[model samples]
Target: MTKQDALFQYCLRLGDDALILGHRLAELCSRGPFLEEDLAQTNIALDLTGRAQLYFQYAADLEGRGQTADGLVYRRPERQIYNHLLCEQPNTDFAYVIARQLLFSAFDRFLLEDLCTSKDERLVEIAAKALKETRYHLAHASDWVYRLGLGTGESHRRMQQALNDLWPYTGELFEIDDVGLHLLEAGIAADLHTIRALWTPEIRQMLQKAGFEQPADDYMHTGGLKGIHSEHLGHMLSEMQYLVRAYPEATW
Candidate 1:
């Protein structure tokens, strides 16, 4: 594929990841265990959704297809989305929610830090702004991981179970395909190998401190990068894209 094509896919994957994950977090807005934490999750959702918008805008420029961020997000079908399988997984419980957040944030903090040096100015700018919020996200989620994992017997069991279940999906975050290789050669992307190097130890330390054992590398489930997704993503889009699809381009 051309570099332009690679960049478009790269941005699509990034934007889709953020948009879907933001939607996941937003689902917790009124349902957080308490008011302050509820607002915190909502604020993080805003940060993620804003980041998705920035990346989608860049992707639209690359595509030159007259697509706005709203058009790209709301108008896309399930087969067109490129988010990771992990991001679209349902938040089944608070332990699961915190485990998912901590896992993603751990990798994201390092990944965005490296992307800050991208040759692509737009990526660099977006990464710089995003890194700060990701750091906060990691800290918040990591604290909860520690608290819940070390708290009571039931909480500890739940936290460990969540970690074991989610570990398989973590591998996909660092999977670099041809598009990523091309972007890496152009100095517009971080080396996923390098990012994984940094991410592994940091995440392991958090789990250790939480008194949880890291799960073995078992059978893994992937395919989201190639537009294959879990059933949850389509269900999410039904709710999220309703107003945008129903209204087309109504300027509010």
Candidate 2:
């Protein structure tokens, strides 16, 4: 792909990942185990959704097709969206929620930190802001993983199960394709190989602290970057895009 096309795909993937994960976290609003945590998850959701807007707006500008950020998000079909599979995984439980956040946010933090130095000024700006929020996200998830894993037998079992089940999805986060390679060559993208190098040890340490071991990598799932997604993503898009699909011309 040409550099412009690569950049557009890059932005699309980033925005898709953030938007899907934000929606998942938003689903937990008012349903968190407690009030304070509820508000915290909501705030994180807002942070991610806002970041997704920034990326989508950049992508829209790049596409030059008269698309707005909202249009890109709310008007896209599931097969056209490119979020990581891990991000779209359901919030099966509190343990599952924390496990998802722990894995994704840990990688995101390092990736955003590297992106702060990107040649693309807009991406650098977005990554700089997102890095700050992702740090908090990682910390929050780390704390919960520790508590839930050590608190009781049931919580420990649940936490371990979540980690194991989600482990396969983690592989997709670092899968760099042609678009990524082009951006990497142009100095506009963070190196996933480098990011993975930093992410793995930190995750292993966190799991160890939580009385859990890193789940063995077995049968990793793929295809999100190419727009293939799980059934859950289709269900999520059906709900998330309903308003825009139903009222194509309506505006606030």
Best by the lDDT measure: 2
Return the clash pairs for model 2, or none. Answer: none
Reference-based lDDT, each prediction: 0.91, 0.93
> Can you tell me which runs of candidate 2 are displaced by over 4 Å?
none
Which regions of candidate 1 fall more than 4 Å away from where they truly are? Answer: 249-252
Model 1 worst lDDT window (10 residues): 243-252
Candidate number achieving the greatest TM-score relative to the actual structure: 2
The local lDDT score (0 to 100) that residue 186 gets in candidate 1 is 97
The lowest-lDDT stretch of 10 consecutive residues in candidate 2 is 243-252
Candidate 1 per-residue C-alpha lDDT over 131-230 given as tens digits, one digit per residue, 9 for 90 to 100: 9999999999998988998899999999899989998999999998999999999999788899889989988887888899988887888898899988
Q: Tell me the TM-score of model 2.
A: 0.98
Across residues 192-223, which tens digit of lDDT does each residue of candidate 2 receive? Answer: 99999998898898889879978998899999
